[model samples]
Target: MKLREWVEAGDDARLLVIIEAQDVLSVELLRRQLRDMGEVSCSEQQAGTWQLGLLAHSCGSLDVCLARVQGKVAALNRGRAAAPAELVETRLVSAAAASLACAPMIIGPFTLVSQDELECGPRQIRFDGGKAFGSGSHPSTRLAVTLLERTAAELVPARVLDIGCGSGVLSLISARLGARHTVGVDICPDSLAVARRNVERNNLSSRITIT
Candidate 1:
């Protein structure tokens, strides 16, 4: 299903299911299992909780979708699930944009800009706020970016490796900061896809590799 369509569905749209778990592993597993049923996105929440959001089409009823998701969550967590899947409000895109806007994080020379904002200057990274993580909003990602910037001069003309790369932000930034080549590795195929798109968005395909 097209996520844009779901986001724009308005009042006629079926409610989207948001499943919460305490750990990233459960979130990842739920994402893998429920992806085929709809569009799934996972993110880390406060208090060590992780959320898996599934945006399903209005073609089916909300109850049916919730039941299916609950069953999947049960299978993954074996009755230890943190919480049941709930129906979230509409305007999914707006909600996502707001979440990103809540924290305008600056990482080194790059500043993460929201969709509504324009890139007023150079060294700005724009994220569409897609399913993959790493919009530079998280503390860990910001820290990594800061560390990379501090050592960017030393990393010039060198090959850099990024493990668990999300949204390929680090790899892209590394390439921008003078790394001759960057290799981003992630276990999630969905994350790799998002990273590849981000790499292409910044027009650094040749300098960065996402796998």
Candidate 2:
């Protein structure tokens, strides 16, 4: 069983801790221990998995959140250090953890994500199971979109490239924002799949090309 929990100390602060175990009792022990930090909740999931979520507080700004989490993780290292796992194997680091918090961004009539929506945005972009890649939830992408909205005419770059396009959410957003023409490329095929579905979901296949 694997248990994961997150706590936000501020608008953009995010802290996540996870415990992995083979037996239920061990998992329960860790869950109980972590619970003392803040509000605790657990939901039994399929395949004998239990998800534990936590909300905690510590003094700091959003800028310090990542550094603080890194410090905490470093403090926990105690000595030995293994290569960081790609996925959240037993820890989450530099992961697009926007779900750790969410901020509302007003797009047209409805609000797009403004703060940490990745932490709150649907796990799957429009429910494309295997799709994985860049999250529009990042502040960087959100801010870029805002800039694009205002200075697009003056800063009209002939071609736009997303170095690490994830689920194609941001790329599609560009198309939806009127880029004349756009193409989204991702190193991960799953992300490409997700982007394609997202395009179709928004019916933007005609505007944005996904590769």
Q: What TM-score fits each model?
A: 0.54, 0.40
Per-residue CA lDDT of candidate 2, range 78-127, in tens? 46353221112223222345343322223322233322223333322232
Clash pairs of candidate 1?
none
- lDDT for 149 in candidate 1 is 79
Deviation from truth (RMSD, Å), model 1:
6.8
User: Could you tell me how far off, in angstroms, the CA of residue 99 lies in candidate 1 after the best superposition?
Assistant: 11
Q: What's the residue-level lDDT of 40 in candidate 1?
A: 52
Give the residue spans of candidate 2 off by over 4 A. Answer: 1-131, 154-159
